[model samples]
Target: MSPTPQAVYLNGEWCTSDSACVSVFDRGYLFGDGVYEVIPAFAGRLFGLDEHMARLSRSLEALGIVPPLKHDDWLAIFERLLASTDAPDAAIYLQVTRGAPAKRDHAWPDASVRPGVMATVSPIGAIDGGARVITLPDERWGRCDIKSINLLPNTMARQQAVEQGCDEAVLVRDGLVMEGAATNLFAVVGGRLLTAPNGPRILPGITRGLLLDLVRRKRLMELDESFISIGALREADEVFLTSSTKDIWPVVEIDGEPVGAGEHAGRAGPITRLLDRHFQALKTRRSDP
Candidate 1:
C-alpha cells in the first residue's frame, strides 16, 4: 500500500497533516460548534463545488457563525490544496469552527475572535461493490439540517453497522426512514423512486440533489420526495444510498434480508444499476472539456 497524502491547509496557510493543529478551547472541539463540507474531485475538477459551498454557507448561517472567507477565496484555497496532491481522484474536506474563546464558557464568545478554518485532501478510490445496510433509530439532535460537527450519534450508528458487518446504517425515526448515518437514502417502491423529504430531520445532500435532477431529466422513473416508512422500505423493489464519496451505492441486503423482488432479490436491482450507469456517465461528461 502507498503512503497517505500529507498536504493540508489551515487558516490560509499550507502545512502537513502532522503539523496542523487547532485550539483545544475551540468551540468546535468543546461544543461541536462548527460545520463542514466534503467535495469529490475527479480529474482535478471538484464536483458540485458551488452546491457544496452554498450548503456550507447555509450551515454556518444556521449556526450563527460568520464565514471566514469569501467564495472565491475558498475556491482558490481548494485549488491550491488539490494542486499539491498527485491523485486525480480525491476528496476535499473543509471545515469552519466558531473559534477558540478566551475561556471555556457555554455562552457565545466575542465576535472579535476569528473563526477557525481547515482543509485537507485525500486520495479516493473507485467504489467496487454494493453495500449491506442495517437500520437504526435516528438519535441525532433536531438540527440535522445544519451539517454541524456534532456527529457522535452518527458515529455510533455507523459503528453499529460496522460491527454487524454492514457498510452503512439507515436511520429511522418513528418508523419513518430519514437517511443514512453519513449519506442520503433512496428507495424504489412499485417502480417509483421515493426519498425522505428534506427537512430538519435530514441533511440536504448535494449528490441527492444531482441524482434527483438526473432522474427527472432522464425520466427513468417517477420521483417522489416524501417519507419512506420502515415497512415500505422493507417491501420496496430496490434501495440505494448517495453521498459525495460514494456516488450511488445499491443496498443489496438490509438487516440481513435480501432487497428487491423475489426473482432478482439479494442483488443490485435493475433500477439501481441504471442509476449507477448514469452517474458514471455524468462524471465522464463533467470531466471532459
Candidate 2:
C-alpha cells in the first residue's frame, strides 16, 4: 500500500512526518526513557482524551520524566491536530521523552532535561468481528503498569502471533492470563464479567472501563476485575476483548480451538448483542451533529 501523508507535531511545532524528527542521542532513544499514549478518534472526535492524558501523566510520573507543558497545554495541541487532520476517524499518537542530553549515563542529567513531546494522526478503519489471537508465554516486565517506550517485547509477541496466523497474542503469565499484547482480555463466567485488575502488571484500559460500566448499567452481568487462569478462559461461557481501536469483539476461537461456550458461543449471544447496541449508542451519541 502507498504511504499517506500525515501531519505530525513535535516539540511545539507542526510539520510533516519526515520533518518531525528527534535527536538520535535523546534519552528516549538511547535509554528508552519515555512514555506514550494512543488516543482513538472516532467519527472526528477523540475518544477518552482525558483518560488517555491521565494515564500519560501517570506514566511520566512513574518514570520521573517531567512534562514540558501542562495538561491543558497538551490538550490545546491535541485539539489542533484533531481539527487539522483530514481523516473522518483516526488515532492520535502522543509521546514524551526526556530530551537529548550531552552525554549518555544511567543517571539523570544534572539539570532537568526538557521533555520531548510529539503528536501524530493516522486514519482509522473498521473493527470487524475481531481477529483471532495466539497465546504466548509472557516475557514482559512485571511492571506493565507504566506505558513506557520499552516495547521490544510487545513487538516480538505481536510478530510471533502474526506468524502464527493470529491478529494478537494473549500473554499468559504462569498459567494465568495477563492481557493481550495491545488490548485487554475479558471472559464471561456464569454470566459474570472477568478481567485482570489494574495493578503493576496490567495497564488499565479506557475502553474496557467504559464497556464494563455499560454492562453493569444494563444489569446484564458483573465484572470481577480479578485474575483468571488460562483454564478459566478455556472454560468460559463467553470470551471477548476490548481496546480503543477494536472496541468490543467476541473471541469465538483461540489457537483454532473454540473459546467460551465453544464453537462460536458468543458470536451474537444475547449479552453480546446488547453490548454491541450500547456501543453503537455511544458512537451515535458522540457523533450527533
Candidate 3:
C-alpha cells in the first residue's frame, strides 16, 4: 500500500488532506449525520467491493439518504483512487453526508440539498498479533449495523483500553460479547468457533464474513454464529478480532488474563492460526466475488 497518501477526494475534487475541508454546517460535522465505508484494495485489486458496497447502500438507505452513485460509478471512483495510490494494500475510506443547509435546523433539509461526498486512501500498515483486549460495555446506539460515522462510544472504549495497556476493546452488551470497538470478534469455545451473528448490535465486518466462509468451506472447525458471554470469551481457548485493515488479530490476553488451554494457553491457539493461514492465502485472490 502507499506509504503516504498524496491526496484525498473531496466533493469530486482531489486535494491534500490539509486543503480538503467540508462546510462547518455539514451534517456529518455538526451531528454525525453520515455513513461511511472502508474498503481495502490488495494487489491493485479492490477487495470485497460487492459486499462493502452492499453494506454502504443499506446504510444510506437506512438513513433515508438517496444513494449518490450507482455501483458502476462507485467502482470507477475506487479504481481511479487505487490507481493514484502507490501501495498495493491501500484502504479506501469514503463517506456521504447530508449537505450543509442554509440554517442549522434539526429537521431534514430541503430536497434541493445535495449530498456531500468525500473519499481518501491510506496504507494498511503492518499489524503485530498477540493483541490484549479488555471487555467493556457497548453503549452505542441501537443501530450499530448502520456503519454511521458516530463512533464516540467505541473511541472512548478503545482509548480506555489503550490507557490500560491493552490493544483493543471488546464491547459487551447485556453481558454478552457484542464485538470489538471497530472489529468483529470470534471465540473458540470447546473447539467450536463462536461469533456474534450480524445484527443491530454488531457491525458486519468484511473480514469477519470472509473468515467465517473460509472456515465453513474448508471445514476447518465447527462454526456457530451466536454470542459467547463475556465470561466465556475471557476463558476461551482462542480469541481473535477481524477488521478490514487489521486482519486476524490473535487475542493472547483478555482483561489481563491469558487465553487458550493446554500447551496453546496464553498464545495464539491452533484453530486461530489455522484460520489465519487460510485467511492469508485467501487474501491472494486478486478479485473477490
Worst 10 residues of 1 by lDDT: 2-11
What candidate 2 gets wrong by more than 4 Å, as runs, is 262-268, 286-289
Candidate of highest TM-score:
1
Candidate ranking under lDDT, highest first, comes to 1, 3, 2
Q: lDDT of each prediction vs. the true structure?
A: 0.91, 0.81, 0.88
Best by lDDT: 1
Clash totals for all models, in order? 0, 0, 5
Expressed as tens digits, the lDDT of each residue in 181-222 for candidate 3 is 998999988889999999888999989998888888989989
lDDT of 2 by residue, 1-289 (tens): 7566567888888888766678887888998888999898887877777788889889989988876788788777777888877778888888988888878888887455687888887777886665688888999987799998888888999999899878888989989998999989887788788999889887788888788777778776677989999988878777777888778777767787766554555364556656778987886776676
List the lowest-lDDT window of 10 residues for candidate 2. 260-269
Task: Name the 10 consecutive residues with the lowest summed lDDT in model 3.
Answer: 1-10
TM-score of each: 0.96, 0.93, 0.95
Candidate 2 lDDT (Cα, 0 to 1): 0.81
Model 2, total clashes: 0
Which residue pairs does candidate 1 place in steric collision? Answer: none
